[model samples]
Target: MERKEYYAVIFTSKRTDGDNGYGKMAERMEELAGQQPGFIGIESARDANLGITVSYWESLEAIKHWKENSAHQTAQKLGKSSWYEDYFVRICKVERDYGMNE
Candidate 1:
């Protein structure tokens, strides 16, 4: 069967200096996101100061809800104030995808 269209939230970031609780918060955020409705999956990678996390969602409304989540909001504030030097978030509609395992 063909997969339906979905949304991917691509979050790219540059770290400030040290962990300072970032690792714990990131783990918590991932756990919370998995519990949310319409969450598909997530992938993340980091090297030195740069990081990229791509979270899949069923729709735009789902993404909006995730953004409004209180814990996630707190994390965002913390990212700006403490952990991240800079970041970018891009939402893309995925109409088709191909992978080796599939």
Candidate 2:
């Protein structure tokens, strides 16, 4: 099947100097996000200093719903307070995508 237009929420973050249950919370959030109405998938990478996570959704409204989720809001607050040094979130329209056919 051909790919269709979708929304992607790009989250880039720099973390503070500790674990502090970030791993557990991140895992939980991913699990929760998968259960959301518009959630399609998520890709993420992290290192000692910085991390990037992108989540795909069927629509902008779905993205907004995930953003306003109560658990996600708590996680965002905790990120600002303890986990992240800085972060940015960008929502973009993914009009086209291609992948290798190997």
Candidate 3:
């Protein structure tokens, strides 16, 4: 079967006061997501008050499943409560993507 391609979900969040727990939760989420059937990979970054994460998936269904996952949902709730003051999620399809190793 040919694999269907999907947009990469890019999430950016601004952290609030108690963000120490975010790192651990984020790592766990990534690890768990990586174990999912359609997961590709993930990349994340953080600055003084901002956190950015990009995760690649095989389909929108996979992304939705991850969003609705229990542990991930809990982390999302905690993100709203303690880690992130605000966040934005964007999905962009890779019509044409290329890279070179340096």
Candidate 4:
């Protein structure tokens, strides 16, 4: 696959020390997401009070399915109640993309 289309999700959060178990959750999410139909790949980053994760997919439906996934829902709950003080998610369609692999 050329991976021309992508869902760019930006998540910003206020993380708590003990509750921000991102290392484990991130790994698990990546493993699960890779198993989903239409999933392409993901890129992510984080800072003191912010986190951004972008995942690529074949269609809107695939993205929706991931959003409604049970594991992801559990993560969301943990994020809201414990890990994150606040956060945001945005999905966008890619019209054109260019890159180089070295």
Candidate that would win on TM-score: 1
Model 4, range 1-102, lDDT digits (tens) per residue? 255656655565667776468679979999999999989889888877677778888888998899899999998888778887677777888877766851
Residues 26-55 of candidate 2: C-alpha lDDT, one tens digit per residue: 999999999999899999999888899999
Best-performing candidate as measured by lDDT:
1
Instruction: Tell me the lDDT of model 4 at 7.
Output: 65
Deviating ranges (above 4 Å) for candidate 2: none
Compose the digit string of candidate 1's lDDT tens values, residues 4-77. Answer: 99999999999999889999999999999999999999999999978999999999999999999999999999
Segments of candidate 4 deviating more than 4 angstroms: 1-3, 100-102
Q: Please, what are the lDDT tens digits per residue for candidate 3 over residues 1-102?
A: 233556699999888876477768877998999998778889888888778899998888888888999999999888877887799999887665555741
User: Model 2: which residue pairs collide?
Assistant: none
TM-score of each model, in listed order: 0.96, 0.95, 0.87, 0.83
- Runs in model 1 deviating more than 4 A are none
For residue 96, give model 3's deviation from the true position in Å. Answer: 1.7
Note the Cα lDDT for every prediction shown. Answer: 0.96, 0.94, 0.83, 0.80
**Global CA lDDT of candidate 2, please?**
0.94
Using TM-score as the measure, name the better of candidate 2 and candidate 3.
2
- Please rank every candidate by TM-score, starting with the best: 1, 2, 3, 4
Tell me the TM-score of model 3: 0.87
